[model samples]
Target chain A: MTNPGIRDDDVLKAAEQWRREGRGVAIATVVQTWGSAPRPVGSHLVIDDKQNFLGSVSGGCIEGEVIVNAGEVIESGKPRLLEFGVADETAWRAGLSCGGNIRIYVQRVD
Target chain B: MRLDLLADLNAERAARRGAVVVTDLADGSQRMLRENEAASDALLKSLNVRLRGSKSGVHEHGGKKFFVELHRPPLRIVVTGAVHVSQAMAPMAKLLGYDIVIIDPRDAFATPARFPDVQLIVGWPDNALPSLALDPWTAFAAITHDPKIDNPALKLALDAGCFYVGALGSKKTHARRVEALKQMGVSEAKIASIHAPIGLDIGALSPPEIALAILAEITLYLRKGEEASA
Candidate 1:
């Protein structure tokens, strides 16, 4: 569970709560996807500055990479767009393994 | 998104209203549009199509890329019965991501043992229906059979503009129900809106099969009713 009273799947609510707690937080959303995507577009992954995170932008495909990028987004207070595809050399390591392409938008919660 | 706008979007969601957050990927500029306010938007045509499908994605227009994040309220199933069919429907509704509420005045039938992990309302329809706050995203099914229980709830649901209103009854039983609703002063249009002999014509016999049929009918209305009407 994300918190005591919120639903486990409510990523926005969880992100808002983390922001209220005075944490440097970033919300990464799956803005676009193509070909056998793991998670649908609009799925969210909330990451705090301390690396604590919840929700998912993929089916565990590129979330670790998103968290890494989110650290910069949180520090800069600017949004960044990230793209990963199976064709990329990082496909097996940091990219989608299921032959899919996805774009994630990581924005700091203000 | 600005802090006030984020709070506004969350408030809209908490009130069960659909909100569309449009973000400019180029500069991180953003604006939140509520469902009700979408009609006046310049992008209403595209937004209407997307919202009808309940989707969220990037929309490209005039060389600008905008991520339209559509957030809609969770669907609800409010059943005015704790009968065998309601028992069968609880799990299916939950599986379909609907918040199911089973209402029955009879304590024995509305017991927790019969319906687990479902919102069970043990009270009369007049007393319980108001608190549920039936809305357009809700599908109301009155399977109680007793007019005393179903009639009032049906009136409330229809008046509240529930997306789907179904009552379990035969043609003859529904004829009687129609007369009773008329006597209660419900509008002719509203009374005519009840889906009699509820559920799709799936020729269902068992309770679970009937539950499947009802849910199928509700899904049809919920998803395709807009296109059908348009």
Candidate 2:
């Protein structure tokens, strides 16, 4: 099996490659976590202009929202710090019902 | 951040040199620092401690927060014998995210049928080890139970500063091996580094069990130290 860190490296490389190909790319990274977050801090999800993504920040709990926000970041060229937790009303809708909290930082890379 | 920095980071990783990518969170600027460089002494010292532990995390220094991403070379295991224990150990090591290389001069024992999906060197230790270039990320296992095969490899592993060196032998056998290493000009300190009667004392009897014990001991040494569980 491949190491998780190596897989993260692949995400970085893919993000750089997408940017070099003139596709808008944004990298969403898990900067902090509390309680039972599935993936640890430093985990990354790379998204491109075509809504394609590589790697993951959460275990299918928050990727859709992050991807939608990443689209806006790519269009505006502004970074964002997003927070999600069980206390939020959208947590149940987004499936983050595991009673954990996470902070993700998203930024465009070119 | 410049794309060339990413290229250089990839180059460092490909060369098996440890590096750290320090990202200034406030500005999103990133700089790659090789382990040996001295440009950022204070930050490098902090980064070196994290790198040695093989961990990556955020750190605060000088009122600024930076994400220190460590890029360490993959851990490696070099088995000097293609014995039954090795057959079991190689795949287990792979499962634990280790790169394995099996070295044995015996054509019959070192056949691909015995060890598949692993790098095999059909040469003696003295010939194969130089190219393997054992380093701190490497663990060396000598299990042929032959003086001609195991001794030279242990010596080379000691010289190369392999993190773990293990040999399969009983207590008496290890005592004699120690004397032989002394005759070959190895110091007491270096000879003490060898984990003879290799593996943790888990009362392992079968080959696979012994492989598990050995891997456990190697992991303990890598994470902790000889003082903790040798």
Candidate 3:
């Protein structure tokens, strides 16, 4: 699923604030969703101040993936896309079913 | 953590944290204000009119930025059709965080017994589309195979500027639909907006599969708009 307008607006707001404050902020978005997915496109799930987050990419399957990669995002302060689905069985154990896929894009605000 | 006081003024009461741009002009202003100080004054003026309890931060650019936040409503989806595909679609759309409303003219098709969580509408598309008030934020799907119902509904939705307008049918069926719409004087550009054979070609055949595909397409359209703005 993609991120919604309001959610993206929130993330943008947060990111800009982080930039002003000189603190790194990472924005994660569910850009693509497949069969039986939990969240829609434009679903905003913001991760900052460690793993503290707002929004959801999946039921819970992809949060850890987001969290794990957040550190890199925090360091790089650039956007990245992470994909999870049946193709990645390791991701399935995280919570999603077979055939369901999601593309999460992460960007650092600060 | 600093509170987003400007958000409170925007009537965002849900405590969903967000930020607001403290612009110097109201939404309807046509010309840009020339002076930075003048713009700031205008923004302060507008904020006083539309929002309440707002504190502003002045920036080097002279544009005020306030970190205001409030909860947003759940995404809404309006599905027109009580067909089997819609049966799978309503719940599926909900699972993806959409507040689903199903509109079908057939009383038997729009029964609450069939779709318990759906906001069921047992009215013709002509009446239903207006009452629903499809917004740019709303996603609409017309899955009814009957063009008589789907056409009027589509015309209204397109005119209303719904973000996504998709319909179910094969390419041939969609081409015929285009002809019908053209005869109705809908511009070719407007008629072209319909995502015919609605859904990404994930090779769907079953009702559930078709619903999944349609939802995927909707998701794509929604995301594309978000990313463009970002």
Candidate 4:
């Protein structure tokens, strides 16, 4: 419960609220990592059916992508795997300028 | 706006070994998002077609088939000592999102200035335990080196099913403390839960480093439990 530099618990609570409204929710977990990523492994970002966001998987870079794809997760009731790397120019466009590799697992939950 | 229903959804999902995510869609737009999978792509397409045909942008997903709950419990911590270590620890704990409460009998040590935001109690363990109201989810740490302060607090924590319970002392000190507790009729099994010689072996020398080690160990325990369940 005591974590340094984490606050605004409301964000997480808000994400939880959206899930209860019968919206498909997905949890994006940072499982594997390499190089200098903004967030470390075990970081979490959640998206609900309403496209509401909670937590942070990437500092900002990957959240938009995860949220955009999470909408599809709500519809299909399936999970997804997403990856972003420093080598990709398009990923740089998404805001991941750190040039490290990170893996995200998006699992659909109630 | 709608907090209770969201909390319920999260509870349901957690019960089912699942997780929750939320999104926001504004007015006058389809807000249709692409899926990462083929089947979901087709499904979203159909859903978009249906929504576009109906011209309604606001709706729940698939007759509530998924549990997208939104509730988070407040993080709580009970520090059983208002000594200098606890003084240094309280603000850091607050920064980490914990509702910190301090218990100690010494009025000089447990005052408002030392811990401005924390709930300070000027009472011994026996007097404090009843009113503190700890639960299974709460994290407890016995920072007092004294047996009178640490022992009763440890008893309360073990009884309440706290998620984390740690104490400060050397390995030898902890062993002696445990032996003392057994003499006081505390069970051998319950005595095992205390993380004596508290904090990780990070070669911490100062009070702050010691606090960091303690915080890190608590995080490890919690995260490990989370992974086990997930």
Say which candidate scores most in TM-score. Answer: 1
Distance from true location, Cα of A79 in model 1, Å: 1.1
Cα deviation of B133 in candidate 3 (Å)? 0.8
Model 3 per-residue lDDT at B11: 32
Scored against the native two-chain complex, candidate 1 gets a DockQ of 0.45
Binned by DockQ into CAPRI classes (incorrect, acceptable, medium, high), candidate 1 is acceptable
Docking class of 3: incorrect
Clashes of 1: 0
TM-score versus the correct structure, for each prediction: 0.92, 0.87, 0.53, 0.59
lDDT per residue (tens digit) for residues B45-113 in model 2: 765545664456667888987777777777889998999999999989988878899999999999999
Residue A45 of model 3, lDDT score: 69
Chain B of candidate 3 achieves a TM-score of 0.71
Candidate 2 Cα misplacement greater than 4 A, ranges: A1-6, A97-99, B38-40, B44-48, B226-230
TM-score of chain A of each: 0.89, 0.93, 0.77, 0.81
Off by over 4 Å in 1: A1-9, B46-54, B228-230
Worst 10 residues of 1 chain A by lDDT: A1-10
Model 2 chain A poorest 10 in a row by lDDT: A1-10
What root-mean-square deviation over C-alphas does model 4 reach?
A: 11.7
- Give the TM-score of chain A in candidate 1: 0.89
Candidate order by DockQ, decreasing, is 1, 2, 4, 3
Q: Is candidate 2 or candidate 4 better by TM-score?
A: 2
**CAPRI-style class, candidate 2:** acceptable
Tens digits of per-residue lDDT for model 1, B107-187: 989999999878999999999989888888799999999999999999999999998999999999999999999999999
* Candidate 4 C-alpha lDDT tens digits along A64-92: 98898888876775666677887877677
lDDT of 4 by residue, B83-131 (tens): 8778877887788767788999988888998888789988898888777
